[model samples]
Target: MTTVTARPRAGRDPMRLPVPRRVRLGLLVVHIVATAAWIGLDVALAVLVFVPMLDASWTAVCHQVLPLLFWPLLTTALLSLVSGTALGLVTRWGLVRHWWVAVKLVMNLLLVTLIVVLLGPGLADAGRHGRALAAGLPDVGEVPRLFMPPSVSITLLVLATVLSVWKPRGRVRKT
Candidate 1:
């Protein structure tokens, strides 16, 4: 005679059941939303604000172009970082397990630092002083090269995104 074995639940996997299903799903959704925000903000800032400022005239200095953009960029970066960190810590992507997450965290921190410490002030200053400096210059280029930092910052941000996605092999993983 054969005997039938009892099951734990109706539709649950008995083995390989570590983390709770709800927690896993919550983390996944949060990460997905955060990633989308980062990508969207990055693209919009690059194409809309920075690109136009490539040739912004002095008359357009106080046009609320770059100043209007800083908030969005800041918001996107902050949200993405916070949510991503939440996922990494709560889920299996913790620093010890997934080195990629660690690298991304570092990069995101660096980006934030640069913006807060360096770029944000500079942009504000440029917006404030640009009009006076460019007051009477008939030539277009006299407005000052405002586009330089934005270009660099935007490009670096894009690169950071790529690194997050590609997640190249880091030093810790080879061993």
Candidate 2:
């Protein structure tokens, strides 16, 4: 005859030892939703919203709205960065083990840096100066400025997303 043990059970479920699917799904959903929203806002801010403000003789409004986008943009960017990092670490989708992931990480870093540092500042300055030009206010400078960084940052973002989706293996695959 066998004697029963006094211990009820282990402290935690064995399944919990593995990463939860819901956590991964939540991260993906949040990243996708935020990304889509950010793109929509970018287009809206650039074409629909800001242009209308300019049309309505509210140049100052453009400046206000333009700067306002920076906060959400920064937040989404930060979320994307954090979630992407977590996903990379947890899933190990060849991120740490392979070169492509490293490349992608570098690309993402450049993209985020450009947006966080370059694009927003350029847009803000241009918006303010452009608005002033639109109005009768004194010119900050005679030269016209363009927000090229945003365009470049968006391009990098799309490229990185495509790379992540397609997972085009460069040297790692052939080996």
Window of ten residues with lowest summed lDDT in model 2: 8-17
Scored against the true structure, residue 174 in model 2 reaches a CA lDDT of: 42
Which candidate number would show the highest lDDT if scored against the true structure? 2
- TM-score list, all predictions: 0.60, 0.68
Pairs that clash in candidate 2 = none
Q: Report the lDDT tens digits of candidate 1 across residue range 144-170.
A: 345555566556656756766787765
**Global CA lDDT computed for model 1:** 0.60
lDDT of 2 by residue, 20-107 (tens): 8898788778867766666665664565234634475555555545666777777777777777666676564644555666776777
Q: Which lDDT value does model 1 have at 97?
A: 53
Question: Residue 75 lDDT in model 1?
Answer: 73
C-alpha RMSD (angstroms) for model 1: 7.9
